[model samples]
Target: MSLLSPALRRSPAAASTSVTAAGGADALPLRFAAVGRSFGTGPRARAVLRDIDLALAPGEVVALLGPSGCGKSTLLRGAAGLDTPTTGRVLIDDTPVRAYDERCAVAFQEPRLLPWRTLRANVALGLPAGTERRTGASRVQELLELVGLADQADLRPREVSGGMAQRTSLARALARRPGVLLLDEPFGALDALTRLKMQDLLLAVHRGSPTTVLLVTHDVDEALQLADRIVVLGRSGEDPAASVSQLVPVPGARPRDRGSVELAALRSRLLESLGVDAHRH
Candidate 1:
């Protein structure tokens, strides 16, 4: 049986109920309703996801976790409207996400900055066309400073370290002032220290702007630290009808201590769900 039953499928009207059930009326900032995605058709078909029902509330961070090819990123892309779903819908603020808009932005694992452009220009690139040059410039400057890249504004992508480039990508995403930010392992490639720093930065940004965030990652610790709720996608080759296996609530306050017993237990449980024995690592 699917984790989400037919009756439990989310509807626009159910938004209020879901949020209330989740403990507060304004909890969910984003909602997914019977969302499914597939590529091709029939004989040449491949179903990436099926029956996904998720809710991400403002001031809340949710993580998407699963083994590779389990559609973790595919689901994120669908939510971002970077990929269209063959079935169901993705809604932000109860509205469909179809084409790019200022209300939503995404940052991927790689820092996709233009090699030729300086950091400032890269971030400023997302500014709406016909925006006053002065306003655009000010917005870029503000975001650069927010991401701690103000000093590196003149540097090109190649001139900065991987972490710095990723920060630039983050700044660019934030430049849109998106109400929903989708991050697909934005710090996955950084060194350990850099990764932790980036995670902290992400938390700070989310708290400051109070945007709803959906972070896709395989790292259990990452999810535990950043997410208000952790969702585990089924493994590859599993039934397409499967929904998230577990929805683990992350307890504790921001700037959570990773070495704490609570975090360690959550990490171990998540690793186990992913079929990895924590002791073996």
Candidate 2:
């Protein structure tokens, strides 16, 4: 029996040479080449993504937006090497990503922190294997300070507010010093006000340690505010599979006016692509 599934064996990427993930750069470009994913087999097979091609420049932040079940998170999982694409490939700075690639770190909708660990210990959990104790401690401290959790480092997950716990999660991911940060609705669980604050915190985090960021989100406004480009995933016409339906660039620099006329126009276009009437309440 072949090591690869039949679908992967048919992919050009399947033959790629394996390489170790590294801190080759502070930020690494990510590419998805003709990526597709499906589950099950035979008549039970279901396709979630198809022909999804996207590229992120080093230090660029891109947001994936789509209707529920459009495979936004699936695409992100592929990049992180948490799941393999049925076809095509995911490349990081020209090298194929290995399984459980250390070059990338992921934070999901839930903080997923260990309840018993203090915020500091949770962040320390992401340090690379063999990291020197002193250096790791310094890095953890730096990240806690970066995420505004320095004052609460002793608190366990249960003691902190949801937003604080989420910040701790972000800090942990950053501790790995990954070239790519994959966030799947990291702020989706927070209340509106907390979500807004977290967004700003993320921007600050990016500035302090710029890396390629791939964010999967449902909020059009959040995409406009955080992404350098917004890739709308949806099916076209009769095709029931989702792909990059719209790759819209978010113009202007960071700290954009949330109510900017330009952003509003882009938001409307994105919402309409997802089958929502931009004019509807």
Candidate 3:
């Protein structure tokens, strides 16, 4: 039997109910053109990213993999419009991205839920301005249900487990019905078992919603399990800027067999790209 709910397991003929535009309608693609980011001014500037040229097809799931300080999160933040690139530009559907156009949502490692509000209220905060309370409440309930937190809708953030809180955070992000979802190490704070479950839940959610996903993760297995393509970033000797070192495709559909020989081989190659020897373990 499948672990997903019927709604999630059903193949998406259109986008999820949370879609920003028409439900199940086509989403816009994201593009990064020679992007770069640096902190501070000349002579003291620290470059984080450089010459990052990439594109994400509508509804495709892509993973950014790299060591700490390799600018994976910085790249994601640029796409989210939380940070601007110091060089080049980011575009969505061929339009220059100066700010989030109600088309992007972001989830971070920490839940960052407001302690004062109930779970439902926390989620409702994601709704656009001028939304009626009744409508917002309905959307909150729907998202809570989707993330398996409906029963805990009234609880405060302090009352929930870390994983549950993260789920609530995800629900809040999805509340916007964004076309692009940016995840930055969202499961890194959880235990191994909980992380595995979150990965599965993410897959189920994606299967139902069908949005463009840009996930920043350190786990090779997690990227292999969730991403259609894995982008690896690294820095060269004495250069602070991180650049794309490898961009490899993971050819398969969703619900891929984790133990399949093809994935195993691909995992081996990915590990090598990160300077790890698969045979050692």
Candidate 4:
């Protein structure tokens, strides 16, 4: 099956190749150099991630897949500076990340919009602290339009459907014009149809802005549908730490054929890699 709908393929934004960062520079590359994370110390210490050396080209989208507690979220969080790695570094544009920077934006599984804030107001919350009032407002308006939420910009979080709320959350994440967009199962909370639409929306958004994306998801099909590369993490040793076990590139262009023989083969491979026996089912 065609991964992208005809309407999505014909979008004007789909023709754009790159998105501008807050400073108008091109999207930045992301790197994880010997990255590892652990909790506690000594015998009680638990390793969550280990020697995660990976790189994402500017405007590339990479999906991470693994079983629970394999540290996919931890790895993504480390890149976002939400959690510091116990070893090595998470770098953007060659500089080591010390804390959350304006260059990175994250969208979580939950919309997490402030209950009291209007969608526009929530989006504006992502603007840098020093943004001029008018500029911030204009940016919020632009992002809302970008995410197809201009009509609902004034609605409160409770007033919108789950899909619309997620769109609002996405608009908020992009309000800062971040070069790196980190997504943690952003569509996992939605129904199947909504999830598919959101996936298409993400592809269109990426085509328009072309920001570097690191998405963590459990769905193999979702990975094939969106990622340029799928990185599977697993624990090779008895240790709990999860490391990159395989890196599989998704062939063809964006909006790939979901039901094509190629995708089917890849899906089977990925499922096997994830410890699933696709043939038995």
> Please, what are the lDDT tens digits per residue for candidate 2 over residues 137-238?
998998898999899999999998999999999999999888889999999999999999999999888877777789999999999998877888988888
Whole-model lDDT per candidate: 0.76, 0.85, 0.82, 0.84
TM-score of each: 0.87, 0.90, 0.89, 0.91
lDDT of 3 by residue, 240-273 (tens): 8999988877766777888889999999888888
- Model 2 has an lDDT value of 0.85
The digit string of per-residue lDDT tens for model 1 on 3-81 reads 1223333222343322221111122367778888778888978877788888765545779888888788888887777
Q: In model 3, where do residues sit more than 4 Å from their true spots?
A: 1-26
Residue 32, model 2: Cα distance from true site in angstroms = 0.4
lDDT of 4 by residue, 1-281 (tens): 22333443333123234435333636767889899999999999999999998887767788999998899999998888889999999988788876887789999999999999999999999887899998888888878888999988889999999999999888888777787899999999999999999999998877767778899999998999998789999998687899999987777787877778999999999898888998974
The weakest ten consecutive residues by lDDT in model 1 span: 17-26
Instruction: Provide the lDDT at 36 for model 1.
Output: 83
Who is ahead in TM-score, 3 or 4? Answer: 4
lDDT at 271 for candidate 1?
A: 92
For each of the candidates, give the backbone clash count.
1, 0, 2, 2
